[model samples]
Target: MYAGAMKDKRSDSRLVLEKVSHSYGAVPVLNDLNLVVDPGEVVVLVGPSGCGKTTILNLLSGYIEPVSGTVRREGIIRTVYQQDGLFPWLTVSENIAIGLRSVEDPARREKELLDLIALIRLEGFEHHYPHQLSGGMRQRVELARVLAGDSDILLMDEPFSALDYQGRLRMRWELVRLLEKRPHTVVFVTHDIEEAAQLADRVLVLSNRPATISRELHIEALRPRDLTDPAVIGAMKEILKELGLQV
Candidate 1:
């Protein structure tokens, strides 16, 4: 249920940023930036620290207005942050059920809830609270919650960053598996080049301050890519080079 199983049949979700520029007071961040995210595409943004990666996402999500330019989005949007946003008081099932509240039919709502719980492979942990689950499990639950809704675009801001190394690796593959089932338009921001290489259909590498697309690398390799694969390695190296790092 990453995005496919519950997607709109007429889903035509897209995001476009035209001549976008923004700043905090006098300090500028994105300068004349333009971006387009097509329907059912996964675009990853990578850049130096403080280069306004998250600002781009905020603008796309309409959480903030650009100082100049235009932002256009289509269809429903959902987000998953680095930290899981599950309510501490709610059980795993209840937390996921929150997303399905829009389903007017009681039987349909209950069915979706159970389907999502099984989709995350947490069938027996329905009654478990956030504190009772592991970090990875909690993140999975959070992902499930987002997916339970009718969303077309997923804005992810370092969603797996809080997990340990092993946990991060697992979630990476898990995400690919979910996407394989049903693709959705996703704009993901991460500092990890490996993560970018593994998950992106296209990677947009940004410049320093006043961020702009320094490079756009289309990953031709298939998903669930091996870290050692030539395309993954090549993309990672290219991203490092774009970021002014010696590869």
Candidate 2:
């Protein structure tokens, strides 16, 4: 199964950052950073608190421009952040249907929204408002809404950081299943090593201020990886080491 999944991966570049550098009013963030995300690949960025991980996402999303190098994005990009950006007045189904507002066929659009609602496992709560759902449920709605847009690349900035321990774990699996059904080139940013190890196809560790690529680790484990598995533990340890931790 692992080999099959790997074999089906896309070989083309979906996003690339070459010698990218950025600064905020003289405060340097990324410095000569280079990275590439292939089509259908999930790449996670983890680093110190001020190490420009979020800055990388902003650059890819075109929210900010790089000062030095180039950011090449090959397809449509969508983002899912730590906060659940849902409309309080809209019901779950209504919020997800927002992505299909451009579709001219009502039947096709309704089918897509219903499929997404089921994919996120929120079928029965379609009529519920954002304020009525739990943190994890809200994040699921956010993800469903993004997937409904059929984006080529998904830029996620700590989307699950606010969840409790078990909630985060469950959501990780939830994400894997969703992507399996509808593949998207994903760039995820997080400070949690375990999260990176669990969700990434490749994990890139960044340096401190004026952050550059410190180390790149490929996660060869299959889906639904056990958090306590020796491979996962080892991967987390290596990430910690790159961050200057004694472990």
Give the number of the best model, judged by lDDT. 1
Give TM-scores for every candidate, taking all chains together and pairing residue i with residue i. Answer: 0.95, 0.93
> What are the clashing pairs of model 1?
none
Model 2 stretches with alpha carbons more than 4 Å out: 1-13
lDDT of 1 by residue, 162-240 (tens): 9999999999998887666546688999999999999999999999889989899999788889989999999999998
lDDT per residue as tens, model 2, 1-247? 2234433433343899999999999899989988888888899999998789999999999999999999998777889989858889999999999977767799999999999998998989999999999999999999998888546688999999999999999999999988888777899999989999988889999989999888999988887788997778889999988888855
Worst 10 residues of 2 by lDDT: 1-10
Winner by TM-score: 1
Q: In candidate 1, where is summed lDDT lowest over 10 consecutive residues? A: 1-10
